[model samples]
Target: MLSIQNLHKTYGAQVLFDGASLQMTPGERLGLVGRNGHGKSTLFRLVLGEEDADSGIISLPRNYRIGHLAQHLHFTQPTVLEEACLGLPEGEEWDHYKAERILFGLGFVEEDMAKAPSTFSGGFQIRLNLAKVLVSNPNLLLLDEPTNYLDILSIRWITKFLRAWKNELIIISHDWEFMDSVTTHTAAIHRHKIIKLSGGTEKLYAQIAQDEEIHEKTRVNEEKKRKQVEVFISRFRAKASKASSVQSRVKQLEKMGEKEKLSRIANLDFAFHYAPIPAKRLMEVHNLSFHFDPHKPLIHNFNFTIHAGDRIAVIGKNGYGKSTLLNLMAGELNPLHGTVRSHPDLELGYFGQTNIDRLHKGQTVEQEIASANGALNRTAVRTLCGIMMFSGDNAEKKVGVLSGGERSRVLLGKILAAPANLLFLDEPTNHLDMQSIESLVEAIEDFEGAVVIVTHSEMILRAVATRLVLFQHGNAEVFNGGYDYFLEKVGWEEEGKQHR
Candidate 1:
């Protein structure tokens, strides 16, 4: 077993862990979940010896091999295959096929394996690192957001691969479905305490919520008893005949200690503001085609129509033009050979993955959301800001100084401020936490408008996709069914290959 005992860590005023202890049983694939800044990554660093805890014991067996995916970019070999094989043990160095399987499952092709690692993009380099970690036969595998750079196909393949893990594993991901699919146990970091539970993440979170509720109820009952004692003492204080009784009551009230109230944790909880339209046809794509290279078009002769209350999910590999399809329909990219027409009364709210970068550097969170102030009054704007987790002074923080996740929230705030009949969201769940993603999913499902979302998460797709725009085998086609139908009748093209 891996034991962490009496762990206590603090950074200035922020308490990350306090006397927290947890144990990992053998063969347990634990999914670690916590809100942002709750030290999910910090715990990984502590186990890896990359960071020191303030004071604690993280006891692992001596000579235990711990494997983790590297973010560093340093290549020592000429070919991608050679660099990945460096992770193999001394006698297993000849097991190149294992490395090949992992690399292929992670989206690497046979032709690409011969090329230098430096020749690939940053995302591909990260995948190469992931392949190395997977190839290494370690006692414990610690993966943090392994699906971040992967496509839907690769994510699917990895879920299968991880299910076959024989040893212990710990993974951190915002996609609960992905985590829950592979994990045998769930552990969470709540209120600077480690909570480990069997089964999926939902069980752990539900337990935590129940515990907090019980704590609050107990506190309330204790307060009521204390108040009753005080009243009795006040009513008999000046009466000499009841002097001893009042003194005893005062002592009883003193012994009834107060229960500390749990601090409020801000969560992303806001619905999208919908501007309903009477028109049934919101958008039309007539033979749309777009290409940066005339000889090799990314999108060619694609056709789809958008109707009110339609939930269209665009899905494909990384460079397969899923985002391009959204951009073409959204007027961010002009079609080369066709047209995309929208109803004039349609109110469009776009939350692109890259659009967060377009947020004005000098503008505060309040200013950015307030830019769409025509739809919301001053008090509503403040309330919206608070719901986006930017209460009071945080709303005034400049966009230039905010992190990627914070900027994503600001964009959501802006979307909430604007009343729109149509929404075009491209990977909006990238930097959000698990709870935040659930809230966004609820908001999307509740909106009375057409939603065109570009996503790789099957969880979101299964929950909301009424129709699908598929990029399969280098062709874009419309599948007039739900995601489950696509999985049952026609699956991803990559699933046909035997990478295992």
Candidate 2:
């Protein structure tokens, strides 16, 4: 459907691509992979003609219709239904039906259809944007982080939808599982070029690992040969018997040194500092019920207790009281009808979207960590900052100038540094890349204290959660068989109805 050849793009001194080429055809779902700020979006812009490549050609069919999801939705329509129905064809009945079908599949109810789009949360508004794009039914789809704020149920629905989509697609996402389940081809941006591989995202990761292993072996062999040559040169360069051989060896060493190039690897050693597990139950909740409006209760008759060594995942659809429950537990929200009791020795570290606001704008990353825990020395704070991908000079940058994702990392770093036996995290993986998420999972697995996390990431949930807290119909249900059992018993079964 589209072709890119010799795509050269640069921003001043930084070169994003050099002769990168890729081709897309019908029935190919392409997953574009690259580090942040590495020109994946630049390639998209080149394809969309939003930015001119330094020098290259991006060829597209004449009058090809492309449906691209916007990073933000700008709604002028009065109602959510009206915004979703923006691009439908002439048939009024079928148009409305199709719009509603897409919206409902994405977790919007009939009641929500009549509400103003402005009233919906940012996540819900993004779903509306997705609905608009789907209703357009274009020839090619360009989705950038389409599952950014989606719940697990909505993510499953979108995955199933894209899995069955017949046309061409190119998606950029940090969700590896989502890409693996939906895409047929993997396109990786590496070494200033695009490497297209058969199969999915997992195959791309395997290929990268294999290539790194091969590169390591080659480097080792080359280094061994260079050392032997250097030793021979050093031992015989003074003697006339081996002078000519020594000169040749010197030239060979220079050539080897010039040709050597190390494989690029991301910094993935992120680890959360551990805390001592408390001897007592971390927290206890009894008959917890909360509601923003008196007429409709979001949480009703909820009771749960969190103990030391507990790794719990809170999950549900949007507006189903998952976040509210977390807030209630964290004491951010007062319960309408119950008590949240905590052990006197329980030290808590809470991480949520709003935690970013708690960070002092004047503070640097290292300073933030030190301020969080007075016991941590300068070296320890710097080490923690480096583990969070802020090393040396980057660690000295002020929090005010950092990106949203960077600020999120800073808050997480603070939470990790805090001497907290009980941790509360809501959507902690939302802003993290796959590598960072993997590191986070490892850290969570290694944590000795109690953790209560609200996330849609199956990887994190399966790896870190020993129990599942599910929100359903204004009540909470506890599942003791972990995340896999939750998927088997409740996750897939409930969302699969829309697919059928």
lDDT of each: 0.90, 0.83
Q: Which lDDT value does model 1 have at 491? A: 84
Candidate 1's residue-wise lDDT over 253-342, tens digit each?
Answer: 888889999999887877887887889999999988888877767888888899999999999988778888888888888888999999
Give me candidate 1's TM-score against the actual structure.
Answer: 0.96
User: Best candidate per TM-score, number?
Assistant: 1
In candidate 2, the residue pairs with backbone N, CA or C atoms under 3 Å apart (3 or more residues apart, or in different chains) clash, namely: none
TM-scores of all predicted structures:
0.96, 0.90
